[model samples]
Target: MRIGVFLVAAQFPGMDSGDVLRATVETIVAAERAGFDDAWIAEHHFMSYGVCPSATMLAGVALGRTERIRVGTAVSVLSNRHPVALAEEAAILHHTSGGRFVLGVGRGGPWLDLEVFGTGLERYERGFAESLDLLCAALTRPSVKAEGEFFRFREVPMSPEPPGLRPVVACTSAATASLAAERGLPMLLGLHIGDEEKAEMIGHYARACPKDVPAPGHVAAAVAQVADTTEQAVATLKARMPEWLRPGLAGYVPVDGRPRPATDVDAYVDRLCRIHPVGSPDHCAERLRRTVERTGLRHLILFVEGAGDPAATLENVARLGAEVLPLVRDL
Candidate 1:
């Protein structure tokens, strides 16, 4: 199994953006030193949920800092940027980083980001498949032309072509999973869903995937924290995560001028704690093993910043590598 850390650059209350960014980089470096296989960055905008606006930009920083560990985006919102521009960035990173850059793209929500980026609600709702197709073409082919509903352009030659650059798709539903499978791309499953839901999505992908294409290795995101005991790990997150999640979850504004549903912060956190690996090394290992057995996912990107403290988060990463990883690495 491949183990990785998911960096969100979560800006907790009383913490500045610089603090969050610096800690995020430090955590990535620490994760590399702790023998992690990859570091996945999250992109967020106009919200304290995650301060990093560009996952690719942060991925560049991480790739430059670490030589061995791979760097990738947990997801870059495809609706907010042009497919060609994103493809160029991915190609540059892939070449510069020795083919260690992984681009994970997602169809973002109907948030205010669409308005700010001048991509209307239609793009987020309907244009993602077109954008993804264009991106795949730009990455795989020497030159490409797009005459699609959302994008129309003459043939543009791809510079620094990334022939083997396989992008991962963030699949939150069956439609997205099928889309990814049809394209022969791996799925990056979210942390919110349980193992059964993930298994179902995997089933959907298996059914839709073409026979000629080799099966792709899917990635699963999970929240993790290592401590001396189960109670300590649970207490640490319960104390800090809610304060950070309360404002962050409530900050998203719908672009359609409709009221968004309220998220119960405590309840959400409770669910995460229950479903994820948050405990001692042995307990964490057991949880991860069960997840692998149930979902058949070998790639795991663990979210370790829920403690909302730089020192604690770093410790969590180190302990995960030192203690929990060995217990589950052979699985």
Candidate 2:
């Protein structure tokens, strides 16, 4: 029932990176004004899919600009950075933001990012658990040491001393979901999957979680656009979103020189429109409520920027808060 906006800083066709970043910040501010509970910043590298390379850095900007809304990384790619380094940034943000920072980490794809960052494909393929374990230790323990396969370090005291931080893991598979459950951390489900898949993942987490740990509330990401009528909302997204999606989806490059799957941009958009809350306020609210009921998701982060237009995106955020939220807040 806790609603939020997912900021991708997506560079649509004919838009500059600077403008996209500024608009993303503006969206975060608008989200807080519109009564959103959180703003999740996405991290992408070497692509027009998302220009923001540093989710934590953008999160700092958002936290500084907004007082009430919690700021988090949709994911800081753990495969590309040292876990201790990310932990330090998380701790600093948590301390500075008065515990309003949520650290969400993920094992990014086997993209060229691994090559550029020099982490190699092995890190992305087999190093996530070690990195995640080190990250958790860095955040919770006063002093941390690691002797894992991917990382080996001497004991070092945590600076800024993580203010009781509990990171959310971005889970794309049962293995990842079980890993998160084993650590007693919640999962951040992506926008690509449907309710049934998400419910299955949650079931995996529930079955794998230790008896000593209480069930963690999971977060779900979904596309949302609000308009006076269903036709208007669907039309707006269909027209504007493909402009952003076509190039963005084609930007990924595999690290090992293997060909990546081609995404059918229009077909993907159509799928999202069918599955997500993209319609009139009443319809959007009902869709969201159904999603919550079906998946048992406690938090919902809506991709309000699906229109790929700043003004329309802002309007969507405001309308979502004003009309859609009231109907679904109690769910």
Candidate 3:
């Protein structure tokens, strides 16, 4: 039951992107003091949705600030990136963090990421496999040489090597989750699925996982929040919270004439109640424990307050860390 802070880098009103960057690093500093185990950064780009486009670069900043906490990408979009560059950067970050870096890889998303990159979704799965295979090869052996449909590497040794968690790659979709298991990699799940989905996906990984593997397949779910009261917590979530969500989001999101996401907190809550973990400290802790217990998920990454108001969001985090996290320490 280890707790981790996943830096979603959600935007706040009147705060510059740089301000959020500083806030993120400071939050990690505070989280370390609060006795957190690991910290993760997400991969999002070309939108106001996420601030840390270069997740590894920001992770390097965290490396310089913290001494013992582990750091890595919540996901490094593998499809849009070159395998060689991904390997080199992660290796450098690993050295920067004294071997505390673990690479979380993904094939980006279905529409927004793939469409933005001008790549078709039909072969997306194949590209994901290709990218993961290439990146892993580059990280493990020196003088890498390989060729695949989408990526190629040759005569390149990933110097100095990444330590601690070693070179790990993960993807979010269920099929990809099985792929991670096939390759003996850890898996990161999106925050917006139900209990049944969690059980089934995690179970899929476990079933496909090899018994002799060093580390068994892992499940990291991204729904976390803490507030003084459940009522107050729901109040803290803003009207515009759903606006920050990607347009390519899954589920029954109907149009409501606001260009993108409209005033659909009803539709929003339909998905959110399943994905976003929010509640008072006591309830939050107990619910989180139950979710993990049900799925046996070890890595828990929390996105506090749903990301609409940063100040209120931080307040939620302060309360959550102070109360809820302590309650779940042994559970």
Whose lDDT is greatest here? 1
Q: Itemize residue pairs with steric clashes in candidate 3.
A: 143-157
Q: Quantify all predictions' global Cα lDDT against the true fold.
A: 0.92, 0.91, 0.68
lDDT per residue as tens, model 3, 239-329: 4455555331332121222233334545665465444566677778777878777887776877653646656556656776788778888
**RMSD for each of the candidates:** 0.9, 0.9, 4.2
Q: Enumerate residue pairs that collide in model 2.
A: none
The per-prediction tally of clashing pairs is 0, 0, 1
1 versus 2: better lDDT goes to: 1
How far out, in Å, is residue 328 in model 3? 1.2
Clashes of 2: 0
lDDT of 3: 0.68
Where does the lowest 10-residue lDDT sum fall in candidate 2? 158-167
Model 2, 108-174: lDDT tens digits are 8989999998999998999999999888888889989989888988999999786668889999999
Candidate 3 versus truth, CA RMSD in Å, comes to: 4.2
Q: Write the per-residue lDDT of candidate 1 for residues 116-185, one digit (tens) a residue.
A: 9999999899999999999988888889898899998899888877555778999998999999999999
Ranking by lDDT: 1, 2, 3
